[model samples]
Target: MLKKLTQSETLAEQAYREIKQAIIEGRFSPGEHLPEEAIASMLGISRTPLKKAIEKLSYEGLVDLRSGKIARVAEYTPNDIENFLQLRVLLEPFNVEQIVRIPISEEKMSELVELVEEQKKAIEDNDLYQFIQLDAEFHLSLAKLNPNQKLQQFIEQLNNNLHRRYLILSKTLEYGSKTAYEEHVSILKALQKGNPEEAGRAMKTHIQNVENRIRGYQASSLH
Candidate 1:
């Protein structure tokens, strides 16, 4: 349920958070037009703040905006998602390979363990929003560990692009959250062993499985 906006940094920033959450949680479906007037009313704000929020979202690749036309949620075609996943298949494995070279500290390793455990709880509780967020946390956490800033930026971009799709698809594929959690565990285990080869392979498999799940769902829906 959307809450009424409370005074914070700025109305626009708060609206952005509210609207972005709605989009990611599937309340605002992809390609759906954002009726500025209605949303402004809902949040108890005027159109100015809402438009600023939309512009911010559009910049983040979460929303699509045109100069004169109405704003709409960003829609990723199959190819768009595939391209994102393919790059991830390359960069993320390399990310873990680098991580293994650093020999992640016991404390750092424990944090990763805790993160995945939180994911498990998110699954058991059927907390879709939290589950999706934690899924991003896992990847982004690993990406940050590497010293490569450019690589981190690239991975975050891909992660942001796929984030919405993951949210949408998870509702249709009820098993995905649990499956992704298990895959994370596999990657973590490989990392724990300090085996670069094994960790990279695990990462490659996890991402490929994501590709397959999305494609499988698309294929079945065609019938």
Candidate 2:
């Protein structure tokens, strides 16, 4: 019984991760109904475990589960985007400072470099989705170096929304990805130097650049 229960819990966690990834990747669009039966069929899991997974997503603000309605992907308005970016500007630089205060292993730094290389290839190939995934991974990996589980979890949650916005922006703006790649390079270089203050400043500047781009996008869209 104990083994079976553990296996079931593991399956539920797996289902949660897969479903969350699908939502972040825009497989399930904002406000789209998530039918339990269909998702279970697609994932080859039973509704019980899938329901548990959906509930977990709801807690993370990725899914909306009302009392009498099917779960839907959470939608963000322009105002929501602005608010999220503002929060990111506050939290992310602090995360960088915390991360760089500790010594980063050579292996971890090399992994980040590999991610950047993958991102460059994705950009060359015009694979926007792959680039976006790597972009999030790059920053989140830095945050993970801080050794604070709660802070890392909070940053991951923010990245989920940021990833969605990045996909939308990438489709609409021609130069956004190129600019972001440049900023990532700057941040990585600062980290490699093992300068905590420089890394934190680089992170702040990178996020501010993102904010500027989003504001510019919004301004142009209004015209």
Candidate 3:
């Protein structure tokens, strides 16, 4: 079955997906060196495909690849996540505030409504991966309502980085996916009501709560 799936994709693409999944699942620990030979041997592929896969992961910020250096899974510490969240605290809240002020169109509004509904269903089904995916979608869709292309791209990068880090911590952190979904619903409600103050406040609070959850976990773990 796996072979059949690989048939539709190049060896490099398949290797990329496999390695990426391993990194996200914490099978490949952060800063873990990935020797090309061993990874190629494990995946039953040649070094060339494995190298290409590592480079792709490098581009996505999941792997660190340098010429003449062995690839290592990217290390994102709590401080690193806090850095991303800090920027997000600035950008995302402003984006959503502008979105609320402009008053999103019905079409875009409906898109958000559908995304939150899907998010709720994912949580009910206990599908963490799907829920994470929808969480990014919800934030990105809201950012897309803004007309500034650069702003949209910037916000997308922030969201993607946060999403990837979230996946790495997934195994250790049972950080209430439902809490996030509920916060998203709060932001959406403010948008629906065309209240920029409430929307911005809700967005800010949601981002702040993310930092709180991570810190809370880290604190508990030290004990």
Q: By lDDT, who's the top model here?
A: 1
What are the clashing pairs of model 3?
A: none
**What is the per-residue lDDT of model 2 for residues 1-223, given as tens digits with 9 covering 90 to 100?**
0112235457789788777666655567778889888888777768999899998878766788999898988766667766777888888888887777688889999999999889888889987657767888887898788789988888887886554554443232234888888888988888889887898888899888886887787687679
Instruction: Give the winner by TM-score.
Output: 1
Q: Where does candidate 2 stray beyond 4 Å?
A: 1-29, 34-62, 160-175
Task: State, as a TM-score between 0 and 1, how close model 2 is to the true structure.
Answer: 0.70
lDDT rank order: 1, 3, 2
Off by over 4 Å in 3: 1-5, 166-174
Looking at candidate 2, the ten consecutive residues that score lowest on lDDT are 1-10
lDDT for each candidate structure: 0.83, 0.76, 0.80
Off by over 4 Å in 1: 8-10, 161-175
User: For residue 191, what is the lDDT in candidate 3?
Assistant: 94
